[model samples]
Target chain A: MSLRIPSVLVSLVALGALAATPLAAEPKSRFKVGWSIYVGWMPWGYAADTGIVDRWAEKYGIAIEVTQFNDYIESINQYTAGAYDAVTLTNMDGLSIPAAGGVDTTAVIVGDFSAGNDAVILKDSTSLAEIAGRNVNLVEFSVSHYLLARALDSVGLSERDVRVINTADPDMAAAFQTRDVTAMVTWNPIVSEIAAMPGANLVFDSSDIPGEIIDLMVANTAVLADNPDFGKALAGIWYETAALMVADTPEGAAARAAMGAASGTDQAGYEAQLAATRLFADPAEAVAFTLSPDLGTTMDHIRTFLFDKGLLGAGAPSADVIGIELPGGAVMGDPANVKFRFDATYMQLAADGAL
Target chain B: MRLINRHPGRAARLFLGSLPFLILVVAYLVASAARLADNPGDKLLPALSSFAQAIETMALTPDRRTGAYLLWSDTWASLTRLWAGLGIATAITLVMGLAIGVLPVMRALLAPVVAFASMVPPLALLPILFIALGLGETSKIALIVIGVTPFLIRDLSLAAAALPREMIVKAETLSASTWLIALRVVLPQVMPRLLDSLRLQLGPAFLFLIAAEAISADSGLGYRIFLVRRYLSMDIIFPYVAWITLLAVAMDLGLGGLRRLMFPWWGLEGRR
Candidate 1:
């Protein structure tokens, strides 16, 4: 008996067509927010765990789910794939992963930046200039690589002067103890651990280059545009928890300790990580930072590094490929094809007690 | 005859072997084309032309950063680790397998321990290895060795122990010492089995090598795939995966050819 191949092909084509057909316009009922472990982004987990997220979401008449991902990159990828309405990621990654992948994304919350959180450590050395002629172990192509590039440039050196061994983040701590590992670049907790070891010294860190490695909660641009309540709900949840986490009170300490324990650290350890991070807990400050000219220059440097590394879309001709829209309608890159935007509207609302 | 056991002639064998792979490639091309037609900038499934362009840049072009071709360097780094791991594991297993196979005392001491160790997942021990071995090449090579050595020892020892008792007795009757029996009689008989065990292990060895490299290496096939994975550069990733698979197949073929050439009497019944 011969199977009807033409009929089968027609059925497959029909299924594809059905998938392509858009649904009738309706108000979205549910939203998902993706987050991973980071000192600044920990408030997302805390809000979700303590029903703070649920309260805000109910007020906005929407169901919001907060999901935690183990791998940081995977969470961004999922967000780019439209699996989540919002995802907590760094600014460069928000640009590189989703915006670069052709997904329209907007930073709803400018949470924080690494102050002294990420660092370069050298064995028996006290200066960044001594890092030359050494093998630096770090996760290649990560924010650490960006930090290393900036570190090297400051010392009037380049990557050619040293070797970059692409060690995994998990291995960075252990790799530092080995005799061959004279120099390395990595972020908090590991930096804390390795710096305590004998003969290890912090040469340079993110504190020198503030506002560059920014953490953000970016949402799908279309989702925020259609459901402004989602934006309001997200901002309210963040600032409420941020207030609790930052207050010098017993309740605040309990809130912070819970966040710390959730992220595999204690209250003191988490507070140390928080110290290294410049968390914009005050709504007005975060909005001010978003509107600052420093944000513009920071993005300019990041785009240059990303474009040079081919992190921007492959077809990109120059650093001006993806247009990043800042506050006050000022545009960066090809303005006609803008995909990434920094909107502090909801943050302003939170600051004015209007949410 | 059952359809499963039906024999195919040479021409038929070639066509039959390639049919499934051909179908898979065609399906992928169609799916990729459909996705691209919808969104030309899709990185999840890049077009065929983009793959060609990616390979040209990776293989033919010298990298602007370090002035080295990435593909060749990655292959060299990964293969060097693989060979070192496989070589050390083979040497250690040969010595230990012979001991455990011939002497009950050695068997009682090691066999149970090895069998238990193999049950423990090698991936779980990865963090400990990095900590104890200090995240250099020593740890990577050690992972590959630890992952494969237990099985190799078990297989080779079984082959040695199953040898006919008459062979050892005849050698003993000729006033041969225990060392002489082990060297002349047992060693020669077990050589072909060692080749067979090594051939079967090529896949798992590559797996462990890639895992180790992914965790900690500056240059390797796995490292390149994973590093670019952060940017969702599937164009580079697809080609690298195919290249690694080709290298593995070549190594498997080379091992089979060596076995046939070195021991003419081995697997003489068929090339199965």
Candidate 2:
């Protein structure tokens, strides 16, 4: 004789199983942030190493873990996948990948923009128009690609006018040395290395589109909403360390030295990269920049470029698919589907001495 | 091991054979649970649900940007390059290996050169290939062929050289031409070993394919892995790696099965 298990018993067991697993709750005390090696983000490493991060976290009654990823993309990926609470990313990448992938992210601190750091260099040609009909080697679908598109737009040309050869960033310098590769778009120190070569001309750079290519410390909007103090602590650490690094005092020099060592570059090399990067050294400046209308226009340009390149996801109907909320309730793209948000509240708190 | 091999029933034997795989699964689950207990947000050793979700997104959902299922597209791209590279390498190996092994002049001229070429790391020639061949499908395919062909040629040549002397002498005594002797005697003996050599080269072939695709390619399994890798989407990465392993294993099994079916007399002794 077989004992029969009733359907009611099965339902009860299923419900019990479902109830056994607890739902994810807010992380109250501990948080982790991931950063990559870049001149602008070096302050994070310095802050963590110098105990500034610990001090700020202690004030907030929390523990913050700062992890450095060797690969720039991996850090952003880790943050997007929820391994880290916050990550350093570019405006275009933040929009294209995470926001487009349906992760609600907020750019809390506008760390810096590529002023002259990203550039288009031509072999033996001093003009942007000379790039027409030439094979340009660059890391395709990267900021260098965006820079190329913008440079081409300035000359009243499009991607159709030139051939793009997708060369890796590491191989860009060497690829440009080849007689066949006439032009290249890359970032420092590759850009600097190539520009210094004989017959290499810097025809265009990110300075041409100031504030368009932004580097940011973005946090998951849900995480930021749940732990507002995390943002405050991060902002505090950023501004304090940034101000110290920018100053001419020995303390500032030491900070820069530490940052340089952390990023595998010398003091002069770090300084060179810094010279090309426009850091928002002051909290008020960062706050104001986030609040400005130019931020909207820059994001609009980025979204359009991303959509056109098919980097904004496969079925993105238009550039407006990923809504970006700026400071003061202004929104760009799809207002209903707002994923990327610029919350200057934390930066404002820092500026107003609230942190 | 002896106990499992001596098992009388097929079911019992199969169950015992799968014990190691079961052990691995249980071990992974234990480690994953421990990690999740400490930090729920850990990306390393992600939960099984996350892996399932990632697989669904990559394999089922059409990419919102390209309107293509990433997994299928990447598989097609990678498989196309792999087969093309392997096909070309096989043809070259068959001709070059046989000629070198058979003729004294060919062996003297080609053996040392092929041996030396195999010693140079294939990755070092990537830049030269890209520069000379351009960053097209040609360069990627060329890289795979270049990477695996030398090793395959050397193996095949050695296999061909090891052929019994009496067979060749008998064929010559029968007034068989050089071409007839090679086609009838050497070719039949070497073909099965060639399949074995091809199987051996699949791992290196995949390595070359991924390296080439990683450096430059619009789409491929390697390209997709590296692309989503920027986001540390382990869910997609783990499945992709698993899929690649599955594909490689399937290929190995298929080749082995074909060898058994086609060359019934060719046993373990026949394989070098």
- Please tell me which predicted candidate would have the highest TM-score against the true structure: 1
lDDT of 2 by residue, A1-355 (tens): 0011123234323333322332233767888899988888999989999999999999999999999888687576556545578999899989876786566899999999999999999999898999999888777778999999999999999888888766667677766766677888999878887888899999999999999999999998888888899999999999989999999999998888888888777788889999999999988888888888888888888999988876665446889887899888788878888889999999899899899
Compose the digit string of candidate 2's lDDT tens values, residues B91-166. Answer: 9998999999888899999999999999988889988988787677888899889999999899888888899999
For candidate 1, give the docking quality class from DockQ: acceptable
The worst-scoring run of ten residues by lDDT in candidate 2 chain B lies at: B35-44
Tens digit of per-residue lDDT, candidate 1, span B196-237: 788788888877877877777788887887788787787898
Give the range of the ten consecutive residues with the poorest summed lDDT in model 1 chain A.
A1-10
Where model 2 places Cα greater than 4 Å from the true spot, the runs are A1-27, B1-84, B99-120, B124-139, B168-184, B218-221, B224-272
What CA RMSD would you report for each candidate?
A: 5.5, 8.5
Error of 1 at B206 (Å): 1.3
Clashes of each: 0, 9
* Deviation from native of the Cα of residue B239 in model 1, angstroms: 1.7
Per-residue error (Å), model 1, residue B46 = 1.6
